[model samples]
Target: MFLRVLGLLICFHVSIVSATELLVEKQAFSIDNFATFNGNVIEEVTVGWESYGELNEEKSNAILITHYFSGTSHAAGKYSPDDPQPGYWDAIIGPGKAIDTNKFFVISSDTLINAGVHDPNVITTGPASINPATGKPYGLNFPVVTIRDFVNVQKALVESLGISKLHAVIGPSMGSMQAIEWATAYPDWVERMVSVIGMAQTDAWTTLALEHWALPIRLDPDWNNGNYYGSTPPLQGLTHSLMLITQQALYPDFINQIQPQHSPLEQAPLNDINASHSAVQWLHVAAAQRATIMDANHILYLVRACQLFLAGHSGSLEEGLSKVKAKSLFLPASSDLLLMPYMARLAHDTLARLGKSTQYAEINGIQGHLDGVYQVQQQAEKIKQFLEN
Candidate 1:
């Protein structure tokens, strides 16, 4: 009986060790002076990143995973097993998983102006970061950045690790833009690319949608022209902006099903003024909950950056796409209205017309644009096949 108990203890210990391995830790890399696509420069910049799996002797097995607009570098692990949430793409990245850790060394990084700069898990130089020149948070002084700037920083981070070439560069949404940028900016550095729910440039509709996201923040009195740091933030504006994003990020059907079925005119008892007895009220509450943790400036900066996203910043789309030499995979969410599937289809069509090696698939899920992250399993097999090829 004692021997059996010892065996059980050993098994339990091993389980503990395995769970610990999946917990993500943040790491930072710095550049002396990082130049922006706009010709401005940050005297010193720091980028936060996380890595999973091993870098083999050949160093040819590296994969770069880019994060979405609201995501961090913690792509595929837990902070702890007891933590409520795993990394955003935990579903598709791990040993024996779609982007198998055993065979590939995966790297992900927080983009400049990443959403949660104040969060312990993230580190980025944004409006919230101190200016080495002034020793105060940059606030509105932070130079505007573009998608190309994001790619430039990632290039520095990759090369710093002694990695000369990436086996693949993959991402969903904003990350997809970065992946495409990598292939276009340095075709020789990337071997394969996976662009999910992404486009070569922001469409007219997307640009208009992004304008709405920034309008609220600009109108908020507390915003004070983006200098509201260390004081009252633009909570109302931020929450409203997030509400707009949440409403659009998920499918209408999915949200309608989750929303309580109740008459819009129904009012709570006078004594219970705080009760959310309607769908709109519930949505507001949810948005507020998410907004409270996010930085308004970060979102504003990222939104503008996304609006300015052009695969070929200074050239025509066809000219930029014509430079891509990496084998590409394009996955569009079937129900996405935010970054519509048509956008992905256009890119695929363009690449095919150029006679580029590419594959196209649609993620048929109810999650809208979010299906790229939430419904990754639907396309896991295809991704594995593409990477293996």
Candidate 2:
């Protein structure tokens, strides 16, 4: 019943966007049922997104790029040149690059996690934001949102654009979860998929790692069961969480090579001007904590959804794989301990058994999970070859 209403809204929104200009724009729409995986529903769903390139007459030449955690919809390059920070995948989505904006229409959206209060770039309406009705941040009151809910919102956005199908759906890390979900829920919509450095399910070890990341923010006294919006937040907790995440995401060799010799965070660096405390740390605890506090509940919800992921737990891995008729590309970082390359192998093997011709590539880079993001140039070449073939 809820899906029925949401479908109608999507049809209406697509009509509105189709009549307007192409390029990039931001808009809001309604999700009638908002059914979450935990059997909860949001009466009204709000999503923020940005787009690149032009939509074709048939709207079939569409590519969806889902982002990792701590990421926004700003993909390829910035909306304007004067912007302070560049887009996340500026290396690949340019004029003539792979997944070129000159050809395919690319869309990326901000997820439900709102980030923190101090961060100005993140425009999220999460737990720390506010409940329009009560005039306070939802905090603990924000219902738990699953990966399915996140994908459902994105599906609504795409459908609203008259894009009934995709040339490909590509994503890394958490974004891969959304790509996989789309394949399962609406298999007919995607023509091809690329999932990098992610798995069909979060293993127990991965769950433990995420719990550690969440622990620090929750421990802060200012967290106050997520009610400390107007007050000073728990800076220490947020920092600890970031540090833990940093340790997990980065390779030990990369850290060792940079720390003592060139980094400001190294214990030996003190007198040199370039060796200042702020030099090497692109991420600070204060910023991380605020981001965590601002989107604490949303983070919890996303993490929980990731935990619920198992290719076939909702049905069967084989069943889910069968739905994906799209010729798939599964690329997992060779050194990725978190997602692990073997998981991709499992999916590849299953798809093969189901008589689906699939391709698997293990990225041979020491950058760990960062390999998926940093080595886009190499990945893009591989992608170009795949798409061209």
Candidate 3:
């Protein structure tokens, strides 16, 4: 009996390991002279993407998962168990998790001008890519893109995969913007959607906030008007910009708890700014570390794109939203100051008033905007239920 029980335990362990072993693959698609919203054209554009699970014969179970700013197509599973971290949404995507890889075919892709282009895991067409016309880096020459442009690119990718209908479209933060755009742009194609910590339009406050993210990079001498491709990148300015973003990305209370003794701004008389022992130092270290691996031009472009985001660019918000035929779910973080729960609330209220099929819930967590991904488990069951319904 003891030997039989031990054998069963070994089999269980092996099954668990096999279940969590996920393979992330990168694929690319190209289009010639893709038109931009700004009326300009990219002579040649490539989109990078990854997929999980298998598409059934009917192809009716395909779900599109969009990425947030600074995110890649790696949304679930691990390249290796020893990896520092799994894909951003590993907690809620797997064989039996919220997204349920066994039941749905999951697909995610890197956005054009994606911020993590410097990272090996991501591929993007941005300032770093050489211009077909000049045989040099586009630098600032790359045409400005919009959320709609992103949606259009993904739409092409979807059609390329022979998928005519999406089981669902889901995302958080910037990804949510894409999901919302998909619903508005192709209402008949999407069956349902989950938009978390996002807005239908870039409000005045959000626009100002995005400007701050770009201001520091613009001030960097090495930025050289977005033409600094071969020279030393603007590490200092990028670091400062990321530092500013970090403060708003996470809850202040959470930061305080982590570094209780370090004040963010405690100055000493007759001392250099660097001589202070404050949480600002920690923020600087963290930001500087990240800035080392991210491109300044990419961040600037993405920020500009975010500033121009509107659910309905060519028409009124009501007119645009009224086009959505999919049942929707909105999950706003209770403590999210960056995106703010109110934005989600407004979308929810609008949909409710329209008598559209919708549900609204706030994710209660201490991580603020980061909670959408970091604390996703808290709402995983609810998400599973919604997806199943």
Each candidate structure's count of clashing pairs: 0, 7, 0
For model 2, residues 296-382, the per-residue Cα lDDT tens digits are: 555565566677776534777778777777777888888776677887788888888988768888776665676666565567787
Cα deviation of 90, candidate 3, in Å: 0.4
Q: Write the per-residue lDDT of candidate 1 for residues 10-61, one digit (tens) a residue.
A: 2332333323247667899889788999989999889899999999998999
Question: Where is model 2 more than 4 Å wrong at Cα?
Answer: 1-33, 114-119, 262-294
Greater-TM-score candidate between 1 and 2 = 1
- lDDT for each candidate structure: 0.82, 0.66, 0.82
Q: Which has the better TM-score: candidate 2, or candidate 3?
A: 3
Can you write out model 3's per-residue Cα lDDT over 235-264, one digit (the tens) per residue? Answer: 899889887887777788877777788754
Cα RMSD to the true fold for all candidates: 7.8, 8.9, 7.6
- With a 3 Å backbone cut-off (N, CA, C), the pairs that clash in candidate 3 are none
* Top model number, TM-score: 3
- lDDT of candidate model 2 versus the reference: 0.66
Span of 10 residues, lowest total lDDT, candidate 3: 1-10
